[model samples]
Structure formats: structure tokens, C-alpha cells
Target: MARPYEPGPSTSLSTNTLSQTPSSPVPEEDDDSGAASPELPLTMSASVMLADLPRDATAALASVGGFPQEKVVVKFKPVGAAPSLAQELCKISATRKFEEVVRYLRRKLRCKDTDSVFLYVNSAFAPSLDEVVGNLHQCFKNGQDQLIVAYSMTPAFG
Candidate 1:
């Protein structure tokens, strides 16, 4: 059988021993020391400044160079009993808002002022009218290199 273990004496800590140690310094409290410390100037090394920035910040700065705007092709797919248009595909400026697509659909359908139209992408979800069409196309485009948008005269896909 193994002998029972015994703890070494150095493990014990007493208040008197802790106060008498040369490395420990006791803080002095001053009730009148309410003045704020002086502010330091904001200075950072190049490597540290780059490291502290968000990952996308560098990519965004790189894209600031001159870039030409490209048009995107949007293919409209009617759902349920929605009327089909003679033209199913249209090209729109990449920077145009999604509201332009909705307006174009309404005009093509000759819908009344009170009629409601719902637009969705990939038969999945409806995007906000303020969303950029180019961004949506870039993210949700189909294999045919076109943005597939499904529309209905009434509420179809939630």
C-alpha cells in the first residue's frame, strides 16, 4: 500500500506574511483625486492599424478603383394562375432598385391601382422593394446566368 501524502509548508498563506513581502505594494486611497486623466493621441502602427480593421474593409477599399457598371438579366416566372407575359426576360441596370422590377411587372400586367402583386426569388422568399436588383442577382442567380424571379397576382409564397 502507498504511504499517505502530506502537503508542504510553503502552500499556506497568512495575512501578516503577505503584508511584509517586499514585492507587494499597498494602494493609498485619496478622496480628493477626482480629476480625470489626460487623453492620449490616437496613434497606431501600420501593421496594427490594418490588423484592427474589419476583414471586408480592405476589400471595400480595393474596390474603390474605377469599375464599369454592368446590366443584369432578370427572368420572370409566373406562379399559379398569374397571366404570362409575351416577354419573360428583361435586362435592367445593376444599380437599379428592386422596386423598378415590380413597377415593370405591374405595367406589363396592366394591373389596377388597387391590385396587389407579390415578387419572390428562387421561389423561396420575397425581397424588400428597396433591395438592389444587382446584389440579388449576384447572390441568387440560377445556372442560366439570370436572376429568376417568381411573381403572382395574389399572395402566393409566404
Candidate 2:
């Protein structure tokens, strides 16, 4: 009969035996100099994952066609030394510019070349003439759903 099989310590596999194999190349050590060694080049993959984001509501509305024109109500309040118009409340197109409001006030007051008129929104800072009246009214309308504008012959609130 053949001899019975026997387990021995030398028959077991170990990390030392695997690393000693000739398949992998060993790194060489540099000379004992004080100079820094060059680093290995990094490798990267170019694949990227992009997430879908929702579109802006305003931009979506604009693409269908520009914002619809609406009638805006303007309430005029005269400051110190400023003359009031015959009609304090008037309706204007939302697409009109603030300069149009200034011109309308000037025409109603019959202002002279030397006269100056200043307009403010909510008695606060003065907006640029090029600003759209509709945009301003939408942003700063009073509780009555009216654009409250204060006018003065001289600079009052600056």
C-alpha cells in the first residue's frame, strides 16, 4: 500500500514566497545623495457624470415670447415746494421707461428749462431713467397695488 499523505510546514504558501517570484520587477534605490527624486506621472480617466438641472422659470417664460404688457397704476405724491398734478393717479404702460414718467411729470407741471424735477420710488433711492417702470412696480408696489412715486422740485432724498 502507498504511504499515507502527510501535511508539513514547508508545503504551505506565504507572502515571502509570492513576492520572491520573478513576474514583478523590483524598484531600484537611488544613490545616498541629498537631491530630490522626480515623481511618477499620474494617470486619470476622462469619463464624467453630468446631472440634469431644472430650467429657470423666468427664462422659460421669456422664451415663449417676451413678458406680456400690462397696465400699471402710478400714484404721485409731491414733496416740499413741488407742485401737484391735476390727476395724482394715472395709468401707464408697463413697458414704458422711468424717463417717460419724468417727462410726463414735467409736461404736467409746465416746468421751464431752468426747472428741475426729481422722482423717487417709495420715497427711497432714485432709480435710473432707463429702468423699466413695470419692473420697478413689480418690485416696489405699495399695499394698494400702486407704484408710489414722490416727486420734488429739488433733491430731497438724493
Clashing pairs in 1: none
Q: Estimate TM-scores for all models.
A: 0.61, 0.60
Model 1: which ten-residue window has the lowest total lDDT?
A: 38-47
Q: For model 1, what is the C-alpha lDDT against the true structure?
A: 0.77
Error of 1 at 37 (Å): 26
lDDT of 1 by residue, 55-154 (tens): 7887888776422448889999999989998999999988889999999999999999999989999989999999988789878988988999999988
Model 1 spans > 4 angstroms off: 1-69
- C-alpha lDDT (0 to 100) for residue 51 of candidate 1: 43
The Cα RMSD in angstroms, rounded to one decimal, for candidate 2 relative to the true structure is 18.2
Encode model 2's per-residue lDDT on 95-134: one tens digit a residue: 8999999998899999997999999999997999999998
Q: What is the lDDT of residue 95 in candidate 2?
A: 84
Where model 2 places Cα greater than 4 Å from the true spot, the runs are 1-59, 63-69
